[model samples]
Target chain A: MLTKRIIPCLDIKDGRTVKGINFVDLRDAGDPVELAEIYAKSGADELVFLDITATEQKRKTLAEMVRSVAEKVNIPFTVGGGISSIEDVDILLKNGADKVSVNSSAVKRPELINELSAKFGSQCITVAIDAKQVNGEWLVHLVGGKVPTDINLFQWAKEVEERGAGEILFTSMNNDGTKAGFANEALAVLSSELKIPIIASGGAGKIQHFTDVFLKGKADAALAASVFHFKEIEIKDLKEELRRNGVEVRL
Target chain B: MKIVIIDYGAGNIQSIKFAIKRLGFDAVLSSDAQEIKAADRVIFPGVGEAGSAMKMLKSTGLDKVIPELKQPVLGICLGMQLMCRHSEEGDTEGLGIFHADVVKFKTQLKVPQIGWNRIFNLKSELFEGIKEQEFVYLVHSYYVPECAETIASTEYGVEYTTAIQKDNFYGVQFHPEKSSDAGEKILENFLSSPSLLK
Candidate 1:
């Protein structure tokens, strides 16, 4: 059986990853190559580098950033943001990204997911959904969670599965910046309905949240950032707690 | 002496480099014939479409240089597969170092058996310090069926050759770089093995 994954996403902006309240660990953590090697050593199951600093010029720089990280870590990695076409997926994957995650573009044109999944295998495609609660319902959000979509979270997840997405990376926007815990309620519903592996993202204040998502929410993996970036939670200790919680993890 | 890693243009080489450094060995990435011929050992690693990989190997002229290496040569994952007779991936033809075809694992468990699995039927010096039924991590959809050159065998939905050995050429279906202690010993064994150096 495939063990649960613990992914630490790095948000890269102009060759540097930004995390507030700068410290020594994070000061050098800004270097993509160094940070990727650190996480790989820290028992990170996988990694994600989101190109949040989207601009017409930043695309090539992002590719270089990806190459730099790729040089350091051999584990599977996913790159997202500013990707809008099959070529973007190809160039990135060719340059060493294992998978290309599409979010805003998928909402604007869902067909891109199917197209890329067709050329490449479904295993190479990851569809990232940003969702938030609105009046007791989790509604899908788009473009860094600024705009709301009429599509229901459950329906959209199922649709992505049908669209040939190998994995659904669900990020709870309400919990994105808060870091309280994962939205297990939303995760439970989506995990049960979808056949592909689900990566639960957003709201991880401590390592227990990862255990909760894997055990309760049925997520195949738990993804976090700030806790790892700021050295608030060391990845080895986190995996230890997950093991103690009876979640099958690779440590 | 610089160790040459044949870049037949398949997968990432960082893991291999990291693995070698951790084991206290120097590895150089190269596809050039002269550099590879001058090295003490040659490692061929690949990870993508097999036919295309072989095509790239041929295009870079590494296909000719690899099999003729006088130094100990090791292949990892898709590297081993490409060294075999044929592969089901991309309906590709492979280098005929080993007389076996890489077939897709029966789709009983999953298309890709992407986790750690046990390796049994151990043979040869590669298993010198390693015990039988020891677990080795694997992440592959296609595997070479058990053959004469098989040194280690593992079962997912069915038993398949996990590692193969022939003369100076050795191939491992599992990623030794990613397999921890057992993998390190196997790598060190390759580096320390005296017979392959001839």
Candidate 2:
């Protein structure tokens, strides 16, 4: 059986983890590689490193960080944020990143998705969509949800799958930091409409939220940042709880 | 032992190299037929479309060299699919090492079945210590159906061969490099265990 994955996303900036990580045993909380290893050991099915750096040397820094993390962590990990070209993805994959997620770049030039999936195979290309409801319509947002577009979330996601994306990372801006729960209704729609896997992001506050995202949202995976980083919910306990809830997890 | 990863520019071979490094072994990426043939063990890895990947192998003469190698060759993901007789992906004709055909998943489930999944009915030394129903990571649209050479099987709306073995060749559909501890152990077994070749 394919188990629902529990992913812990770490925000990377200038080759270092930017968010406040509360893992006490971590020798260096800023080290994304060490943090990744901790998550892998603690039963994180996979890891996603979102490079939030905006520097001329961002590519080099992120590549170096990816190489370090790959050398240390055994599980598969995805690298996203600021990845705009085939060269950027090629360098990261050559340095050992398993998958690369494209957000704003794909929206700016949707052909980029076709080119990437064609060159590198759709299995390694993940299209991330950031969206929020506006006037009863789910509009796509850019620049980390700061910029809104006329593109419909459902329409863009359908096109992404048709263009050869292997997975969809749907982050709902309305529920991102609320810690209330996932946008299950929206997610379930994407899951049903698309043939590829859907990863639900934002609004994961508790273990039940994780359970709801899988059971109710129909998400193939659930990605959360602060909850896992701040020790608010341990991955092992969460998996146990999920299994008790009859949700299949890699435990 | 000299381990050479047959790199014909198909997919990410770096992760496999690093996985071996974590297991305390060094692997060199090579497209040369002689270098790959010289190694005690060879890793055949592929991550892209089958037709194109096979074309790359032919361009480098690796397509012919691989099936003739006497060493224990382990094929992973698309590598495993290519070892079979044929593949539905790109309408590809494979290396014919394993008497199986790779076909795309036609179930109502997702196309490319991603994330962790369990492998059971373990029959090879490749899974010597790994338990039945133990989870391993996988990401692919095509799969090899159950066959006589199947060493392990996994379910995803349909039961299929996850691991296959025939003589000196072993193939696993899962990404052992990216599958965490159990995955690392499988790689370690492949590298350290000589019985696998027998």
Candidate 3:
């Protein structure tokens, strides 16, 4: 059976992890490579490193970080943020990153998705869509969910899949920091409408929320940042809980 | 022993090299037939459109050198699919080492079938220490159905060949380089098992 994946997302700035990580045993919490190794050892199915670094050296730093992480971590990991061109993805993958996620860049130039997938294969190209529901319409947002577009979330996701995106990382802007719960309704709709795998992002507060995301949202994978970083939800216990709920997870 | 990963400009060979490095063995990435043939073990890796990847191999003449090599050769993901007789993807013909055809998943489950899945009924020395139903990461739309060469099988919508072996050649549908510790164990078995030597 194909198990549902649980992913821990880490924010990277200038090749260093952003935000406070609460892992007590971590010698250097800001070290993305060390953190990634710990997460892999702790039963994380996959990891996503979102490079929030914005600078001329961002590309080189992110690539270096990816190489170091690849050397230390055993599980698959995806690198995202500020990846707007083929050269960026080429360098990252050359340095040993398994997958690369493209967000605002893909929305800005939809052909970018087609180009990346054609060159690298859809299996490694993940199109991330940041969206929020407004007046019953799920609109696609850009620049980390700060700007909104008239594009419908479903419509954009369909286009992305058509453009050869291997998977869709749908982040719900409204439910992101709330931790109330995932946007299950929207996720279920996307899962049904798209042939590619849908990774539910944003809202994830408790173990039940993770369960609901898989059961209710019909998500192929669930990605969270703070919950796992803060130790509010341990990955081992979370997987055990998910298994108890009848959700197949790699234990 | 010298290990060479055949690099025909297909996909991410870095991860495989790093994985081997972690196992305390260094691997060189080369498209040169001489280097590949001279190595004790060869890793044929691909991660793009089959047609394009096949073209790259053919250009480097690796298509011919691979099947003729006597060393233990391992293929991963697209590399495994390319070992078959044919693939539905891009209507491309394969290296014809596995005696099977790669076809796309027609089930309602999903197209790519990404994430961790179990490999059961292990019958090869390649999975020496790996247990049955052990999870390995996979991401692919097409798969080779159960055939005479099948050593392991995985179920998505239908039971398909996830690992196959024929003579000195071994192929796995999953990415052992990315499958964590269990996967690393499989790689180690492939590299160190003297029984696998021809």
TM-score of 1: 0.78
Off by over 4 Å in 1: A21-29, A55-57, A85-96, A110-124, A133-139, A151-166, A178-180, A185-196, B13-39, B54-70, B105-138, B145-161, B176-195
Off by over 4 Å in 2: none
The CA lDDT at A166 in model 2 is: 93
Candidate 3: misplaced stretches above 4 Å?
A: none
Model 2 clash number: 0
Q: Name the candidate, 1 or 2, with the larger TM-score value.
A: 2
lDDT of 2 by residue, B82-117 (tens): 999999988999999999999999999998999999
For each candidate in the order shown, give its overall lDDT on alpha carbons.
0.80, 0.94, 0.94
Best candidate (score: DockQ): 2
Each candidate: how many clashes?
A: 0, 0, 0
Q: Per-residue lDDT tens digits of candidate 2, residues A52-121? A: 9999999999999999988999999999998999999999999999999999999999999999999999
Q: Interface RMSD (C-alpha) of each candidate?
A: 4.0, 0.6, 0.7
- Which lDDT tens digits does candidate 3 get at residues A133-208? 9999999999999999999999999999999999999999999999888999999999999999999999999999
Candidate 1: which pairs clash? none
| Cα error, candidate 1, residue B125 (Å) | 5.4
